[model samples]
Every structure is written in C-alpha cells, then in structure tokens.
Target: MKTEKEKMLAGEAYLATDPQLTADRRQAKKACQLINQGDYDDEAGRNAQLAALINFQGSFYVEPPLYVDYGYNILVGDNFYANHGLTILDGARVVMGKNVFIAPNVVISTAGHPLDKVRRAAGEEFVKPITLGDDVWLGAHVTLCPGVTIGNNVVVGAGSVVVHDLPDNSVCVGTPARPVKSLA
Candidate 1:
C-alpha cells in the first residue's frame, strides 16, 4: 500500500490531512516564513533558507514573500528569477529550466482537489507536475495551473491563466492562454 505522501507524489488521490503530509507542509511553511522575514539585502541568508527548502541548481534569485506547500517537490535550473508574491503548491514536481523569469504575484500550482463534493469534503486531493522550459518569461500575475508544460523561449503575458500546454517560442496571452503569436 502506498503511503499518502507517495500517492500524492504519484498524482493519485490522497488525503491532505495525513500526518506525514501535514508535517512536511509545516516544515515548508516555517522555511518560507524565515525566508520572508529575512532582510531583503541578506541574499546569503535568503538563499540558504531556499536551499534548505527546494532542489535548486546553479544560481537563482527569488524576492521575498514566497509560499510553497511542499518545497522539496520543486526544482529550478540555472539563473531562475522571480519577483515578489510567488506561490507554488508543489504536491507534485515543479521543474523549471534555465533562465526562467517570473514577474510579481505569479502562482505555479500542482495541487488540485477533487471535483466531487464528497471527496472534497473528505479533503482528498491530487496533483500534477508543472514544467517550464528554458528562457521562459511569465509576466505579472500569471497563473500556471496543474500539469502545465510551457515550452522554451515562450512569453506569457501579464495576468494570463495558462490551462494547457504551450508550444515552444510562442507568445501567449489572455484567460485560458491562447497562443497569440509564434516567435519561431
């Protein structure tokens, strides 16, 4: 039998209130709090906290006030940068490639609750991985939904809600995030 954490990571429906999951979330919350409370100019302190929280590669910069459910489920490649108010509900893996830039108030979420009222009331949830390819840029207030895979060199306009996979070198905008133009 799979544990709740195992099921959650595998994208299977699991109870969010399971003790192990709750403990992991608590740890992540504490790390986030420390990072947020640390001085903005104290890059070393902030990066140290983030290193303890996630699997980061090379160098990255994230402005304070970041939130995550399970920080261990997230991985970022070289030269990633995000402005303030970034939130990631990383129940499943969130992988970002090199040179990803995110504007303020962006949300990248992998956690999703069941649509059935009974399941929702029971606190059952599932998750899907989110991927961002190299050189991707997300404008301010962009929301990347579960299972979204944005391709290389793509530019998502401000306030866009990406609900589907985006092709490489595309410029996407608006709600539901249709490809407005191809950059190829």
Candidate 2:
C-alpha cells in the first residue's frame, strides 16, 4: 500500500504541470465560472455544479464566488457552510465533517511550498491533508495550514493561524493556534 506521503505526491504530480503530465485545470475553471455567474438559485443546481467542480461527499453549501484552487480534491460534509471570500487551496485533500461552519475570509491551504529557495525553484512542493471534524466553527480570517486536524465541536477564533493539530471540543485562537479553552 502506498503511504499517505506517496499518495499525496502522486496527487500533486497529477495537479502540477510538467512535461510528462497533463494538468487538470478544467474542474477549477468550471467551478469558478459557475460561481462567478451568480445565477444559481435552486439547491439541486447549485449542489450539482459544486459536486462536479469538487470531490464532494455528502451534502454541503458554499456561498457564491468562493475561490477553491484544485477543487477536485476537496471533500465537504453534510450541512457545511462557508461564507464569502473563502479560499481553499486544496492541492491535497481537504476533508470537513458534518455541520461545519466557516466564517468569511477563511483560508485553508493544503499545499505548502518549500521554504528552501533551491527546492522551491526546482518545482518541489509538500501537500498535507487538512481534516476538520464534525460541528466545527471557524471564525473570520482564520488560516489553517497543512496537516492540521481539528477535532469535533472545535471553535477557532478569528485571525487564528492553525499550524498544528487541535484536540476535541477545544476553542483555539491566536497565531500558531494555542488552545484557549475547552468547549466540552
């Protein structure tokens, strides 16, 4: 069986452009067109378009004009809601649990470019899967980094940068995301 790292690298290779690979940008472009049109009213149409755009499982809703990079890797759960200006750079898989609520200006990124200049220049990138558990609420301007797993019933405050895993039923805030208190 392929390790997660191997799988991630393979997926990234599929997304990234190289002489050997035909990059899949169609899904992302299609999603952007549908969202930018601002004409989706019926629940079925909106959901169908989004599902086509992304690898969505279960039911979820996204407010229009939402920007998602490589939408083919995102998996949204039932009753998920993301407000305006939500950008998900889902070069890797982004899994969100049921009843999750995300405020405006929230950025969740799965692809992490290399810090080293040479490695970055060589077209090397690291992707880590981001997972948000059930009933999680993220406030406005929250930025979630790669490989972060937020536990169930977690609430992340505005302007927080989550760089590490957060335990269940915790309220996390501030840069680097320290646990403020337990919600349980």
Error at 158, model 2, angstroms: 0.6
Q: Top model by TM-score, which number?
A: 1
Candidate 1 lDDT by residue in tens digits, 1-184: 9999999988899999999999999999999999999898989989999998989998999998999998999999999999999999999999999999999999998988888999999999989999999999999999999999999999999999999999999999999998999999
Q: Pairing residues by index, what is the TM-score of model 2?
A: 0.85
How far residue 119's Cα lies from its native spot in candidate 2, in Å, is 1.4
- Candidate 2 lDDT over residue span 1-184, tens digit each: 6543345556553224442222444557666777767566676787777777876667677877678766867888888888878888876789999999999999999877778788787776678889999999999999999889999999999999999999999999999998889888
TM-score of each: 0.98, 0.85
Give Cα distance to truth, residue 96, candidate 1, Å: 0.2
- In Å, residue 115's CA in model 1 sits off its true spot by 1.3
RMSD of each: 0.7, 3.4
User: Which candidate leads in lDDT?
Assistant: 1
Candidate 1: regions farther than 4 A off: none
